[model samples]
Target: MAEQGKAAEGRIRIGIGGWTFPPWRGRFYPAGLAQAKELAYAAGQLTAIEINGTYYGSQKPESFQRWHDETPDGFVFTLKGPRFTTNRRVLAEAGPSIERFVTGGITRLGAKLGPINWQFMPTKSFEPEDFAAFLSLLPRDCDGITLRHAVEVRHPSFACPEFVALARRHGVAVITAGDSPYPQIADPTAPFAYLRIMGTTEMAGGYDAAAIARWAARARDLAEGRVPEDLACAGVPQPPGPPRDVFLFVIGGFKEANPAAARALIAACA
Candidate 1:
């Protein structure tokens, strides 16, 4: 009952990119904690963790099942789609790779499967026809579970109306990444929101109270189906809709401090 109530106010999940950070071993995890218990420990601290390992390679069903058993209920994992699918030069040829990833042991996680983040190289720019063909390959349902997709296009060329319209037409969220060398486009192109905050410094507690408060407001705005105008890279008009779910990940920069940053944002959301 308590968990349901908390989820009802807004399904804003705050987390870091991955859990297997060496820096977190002593700072976040207790001293002498078993290395294998990292995910469980981290899941207890944050609402979700982006599965970055999968971006590099695939995992077995047992691995996914174990991850499902480790996390608490309502916890989710925003998986990075395999680079084999998103890193290809000819985007149209990525169909088989996409199928392999989608049909991989991912569905073994069941409801714990959150969003599949299809991150492209910073050099990859928008090619309407090619991009649309790739988006078409994304499965609406993997096995029997519904799937959610988010595209993390790093190039500045993606910050355009045409790109936003294409993503919206396909109901795929255009990732609103935080401080980066690439464009941090913050357009809500889908029913859900995905953010990768890469600006955390080594400041005390990762982010000061003020910064977390501001981010909390932004997460709240996204959950309410509104865009935070100040943070948006493109000036697209807000799409009309009811409130939506949100996934916020603290990643990059002072990577060691990401866990603290995630906890701070989660507290601010409370």
Candidate 2:
């Protein structure tokens, strides 16, 4: 997939939400392809994948190890944080669940582990103190491996300067969710940037050529630590810093065409 590695400015990884889909059997996957070989085949086509299964329940250590062994080098997987940890009344009390998730054999992924996405419910509003406490519960490292965390806040209350400041203080990224009802916070809060774009089904490749070109340019701007002027920012503009790694995933809308959209973005980035 266009030589998965650091670009001229910074590393850019493009992928889809998950690898397993029934519709993809004959469309994305070849006809009569074995189910066991799906991950391997998908990994060969994309640089990264966001694992949504981890959000539902805890997985066995062997499962994580097997996934690691199946994928090739330079491939990475981003896990969705368990719902029990994020879907709570008092976020501060989620420490125990958070601890369980972080220590639940995730380190088995080794170098293949990307960021852990802690997605909050749309009904959850931004309580500065409680949100800060929730961020504090996230560990910086686990089993000698440095961990990266990203929060996907769907509520409109998160579109504020205070929220951005809080995230920046903890060095946790705020996911840029595109083409969804969720508020799109494009501020750069962490060392790396995370984006999830949902392209329309009307277009053959999820998005038109011009739209893909615009997203590719935005991805490059994020990688080089320069916020794109076209995107909305809640906080005051900051000076450009060093290059940062970027993770972009094509999700939702026109699910079957997501892989093609990701591949197109990868080629554009190259």
Candidate 3:
């Protein structure tokens, strides 16, 4: 009940991309931990996880239920929207794909389900009308569960104020991608903030202590509805609102050190 109360009031969640990395075995995972216990172990350590496999293919309903049963209460899973839905010529024509993916029994995760990230190719340019149409296709609810959507646009074309305005108009969060070549958009457009931080291999725990401290501060600012002045904002500044939930994933950098980074961030936030 305490966990549910914290979740309801909005809290910061730090986690890694996925739990199935071979490198994590004997490093993040115990030396002789069974493969079947990986998810449970990861869940115990991290507050959330971004499931990258769903971006490639669909999973059975039992898989979702199993994931929910394996994890503790308040653990969240964010899924990547399928490539078939986002890697298309016409964004507006992706209704069927979106519907299929959303209705594919993901509700089995119940309260454990978090945001659904729709990542676009770097080559995909921003088309305001088409993009707005695509945002409209994202349903507000699925099987009585409220759904939150976040967009990960990698192209430089999406760095414009118009794009931010469009996302804000539809109440979809723009992902803040760190330590990558992708254009980072830090505008807070929704009720929550989503960040994917990729730290370097040179630093221990995927990030130096100073960097982790900075990220912790930034996460707290976002969680409290105060945008950090250090980050770039493409849209005009808006007044701070009520505190919002934050989901931060340590991904794409030193893969082996991601768990350590996430743990460090969690400690810093604490």
- Model 1 bad stretches (over 4 Å): 1-9, 233-235
Residue 77 of model 2: what lDDT? Answer: 94
User: Which of the two candidates, 1 or 3, achieves a greater lDDT against the reference?
Assistant: 3
| Candidate 2 lDDT by residue in tens digits, 152-220 | 999999999999999999999999988778899999999999999986584668888998999999999
TM-score of each: 0.95, 0.97, 0.96
Highest-scoring model, TM-score: 2
lDDT by residue (1-270, candidate 1, tens digit) is 012114434588889888887888889889899999989888888888899999999899899999999998888988999998888888988999989988888998999999999999999988989999998888899789999999999988899988988898999998997777778788778889899888889986888888888888988888877788678657467654678898999889798888888887887887
TM-score of 1: 0.95
Model 2, backbone clash pairs (residues 3+ apart or across chains), number:
0
- TM-score quality measure for candidate 3: 0.96
Which pairs in model 2 have colliding backbones?
A: none
Off by over 4 Å in 2: 2-8
